[model samples]
Target: MINANKTLSLAIMSGKGGVGKTNLSLNLSYALNTGGNSLLLMDCDLGLANLDVLLGISPESNMQDLLTSGAKPSDIVIPIEQGKKFDILPAASGVPELVEMDEDMQDLLFSKITELVGGYQYLVLDLGAGINGTVLSFAAMTQMRIVVITPEPTSLTDSYALIKVLHSQHNVSDFNIVVNQATNEKEARETFNRLNMACEKFLNIKLKNMGYVRYDPAVTEAVRRQIPFIKYAPKSEASRDILNIAVKIQKIRMENMGRLSERPVMKKFPTLDD
Candidate 1:
């Protein structure tokens, strides 16, 4: 069991839009939560929030309600598989305004979120594609930023653009990459090598490999069913790979925090001392 205080925030990003970023986010979260730490998978894709669809849950209230109105985090939080222990806070309900949150609003949300962070060990923020002002700001703010990409040249090119913005604009050197939709292990390694080489040559940033997920038909079927691949096909190839990724992330977290006793857990609102 995780201690009920510490929190870790991970922003899940992608170079291109349809590279299975949400799939990886949700499944890895489920895997991590299985290890005893409470997980809050925040759908940070403000404009096109579909994390709920992926989890097969339609949220009644989301972050948008809290941001536009004066709703508290607890009021908007939707419990997914309540007894299972992991929860998700969907983005604003209904059509997204896409108005671009102002600096004042950003500051207000950040302050409130800090209080909410105390309830969970990990807050996995699934950011949208492209390096817009908002995405870059959130990426720079987080302790860890994961850039997801496929093996396509176009995908790698866009990823470079993202890494450039992060380095030049945010001065963020902490980056990790996960190769999705790879044909096999060899393809995944080659893809990581291509991107890793470029970052070293031009940006002077060394990217860490967080492992890869092979292309699996079960993943597509799970999407069709509007459920996480991990839950839909626990014995499938992708599910096994997701379990590995989860283990790797847990190891990295332990290494970063220098603690192996237990992970952190988010608790009830207002009761958090930190």
Candidate 2:
């Protein structure tokens, strides 16, 4: 199907690396892919791909095959966990820079993905850190963009820089913020407020607080075991926080589906109409 837009495309991205963006993406995927919801978790960090390592699954085809051999999205996509309900499109093998790559190829790749993902209910993209043309382009197409940050000053600054670029360059008005590795709810809220304050004061953008994941040792253990923390430690503090975030995501999913239903024919690629 061409230009199908049935999926609630959500990008779980960050301003910088080492903020547990990939781990969040994995757990979030597991949390949301319940109650008959079919989901696709894509590792859009082609440069420094690690979702495969996080999941401890080796796919036969990745983005490298998609870009180099013109592999279809359907061909490259694999189940996030074998015998499981959700799916994931592994990252490319080599660091293929989007700016360096041909625009036509980039268009074709995303266009194919947009077309292919329509069969699923949700598309969760774990995009690369920083502000680049490739990352921005992918970010612009999703229905929801969640910027995962931390309690660090550098994380806040870099995330703001990312928010600035997307707002100024792409006219992206809305962004969802998730403060990962927070010690407590107060700290998470304060971290979010600092970033939101900067956006409101400078960019005139009001950010959404999607909630935060508490710092938990279970997270480190889960990473070592190459498993989603939510599955590894269902009762852990971080898992509870992520599950709460999943609730907010489900609420938005309903709203997004409603919006899609209004259109006569869903477009191939969807953007923030909110």
- The lDDT leader among the candidates is 2
- Once model 2 is optimally superposed onto the true structure by TM-score, how far is the C-alpha of residue 13 displaced, in angstroms? 1.3
Q: Rate the local accuracy (lDDT) of all candidates.
A: 0.79, 0.82
Off by over 4 Å in 1: 1-5, 93-99, 258-274
Q: Flag clash pairs in model 2.
A: 3-268
Please list the residue runs of candidate 2 whose C-alpha ends up more than 4 Å from where it truly belongs after superposition.
1-4, 82-84, 98-102, 262-274
* Candidate 2 C-alpha lDDT tens digits along 11-66: 87888989999999989999988546888888888777889898887788788788
Query: Per-residue lDDT for 38 in model 1?
Result: 84
Clashes of 1: 5
- How many backbone clashes are present in model 2? 1
